[model samples]
Target: MKAVLFGIFLLAAGNASASCDLVSAPCSTDSSGNTYIREQNLGGGYNTYRNGDLYSQTHQQLNGTYRETYSSGGYRTYYSDPNRGATYQGDPKGMAGR
Candidate 1:
């Protein structure tokens, strides 16, 4: 029982470390040493920058839906309800999934 509990704790810790809460932190660094920064727009929404370049822009609608547009031309829409979200792939300029 003790070993099982320890394993569960370890798994949770690993997951927590791997995930980033963008609202709490202005920036986050991945394991690959790439840094992502979140800058709030004056009008609304936010722009995310990766390695000093535009990565994506997220805008929230009045209905609370989130639309994220990537610099690579890909875009995703997140709905408040589960399974209602949509993602569209765009040209990555020869890069796989960016």
Candidate 2:
């Protein structure tokens, strides 16, 4: 029983470390004067929330594509390995944070 409790505690701690919840994650302002909030996704991506809403979600793909899906249902696909630029689709709004 003690080991089970310890395992549960460890799992919760790991989740807390990667959460994108504004109350838990660190926040910062960009040079453009926008405030961004960060969150971690359980899947293959991380999120940036702005003004209490999901501004963008950046995810990794098996084919080495890094895609950022924005609030407007738009996206930008980039290569993760070489760290190249992104190809935009849909209406491109900047990734603002919550």
Candidate 3:
């Protein structure tokens, strides 16, 4: 599985240290001693929260595609059919298709 660093530097936000291993503790602390916790949602999805604030969330769509949304209003979608990915800033006009 790929490592998803839901930390301060996810988009070069800052220089906070974070380690995420899916099969491990599913938790990490940044440089400021803030702990981020990953918990599975009630249904089929997971959310990463920091200090009680929602940081990011990932959910699988009905089409089997995975979409991740961030607290900053950004979003990313992983398409398995085309084996590609796309990221958008705060709006659809800032889409960076890949």
How accurate locally, in lDDT, is each candidate?
0.60, 0.58, 0.56
User: What's the candidate order when arranged by decreasing lDDT?
Assistant: 1, 2, 3
Q: How does residue 2 of candidate 1 score in lDDT?
A: 100
Candidate 1 structure quality by residue, lDDT tens digits, 14-73: 655444542364666665765666677896777877766888887877888877777889
Better of 2 and 3 by lDDT: 2
Q: Model 2 over residues 21-73: C-alpha lDDT tens digits? A: 33556454545544556567798467877655778888788787877777877
List TM-scores for all candidates, in order: 0.53, 0.51, 0.48
Off by over 4 Å in 2: 1-26, 81-98
- Which stretch of 10 consecutive residues in model 2 shows the poorest summed lDDT? 81-90
Clash tally, candidates in order: 0, 7, 0
- lDDT string, candidate 3, 14-68, tens digits: 3333334332535655656655666678976768776557877778889888777
Sort all candidates by TM-score, best to worst: 1, 2, 3
- lDDT at position 58, candidate 1: 79
Name model 3 segments beyond 4 Å from true. 1-25, 31-33, 79-98
**lDDT minimum window of 10 residues, candidate 1:** 85-94
lDDT of 1: 0.60
Global fold similarity of model 3 (TM-score): 0.48
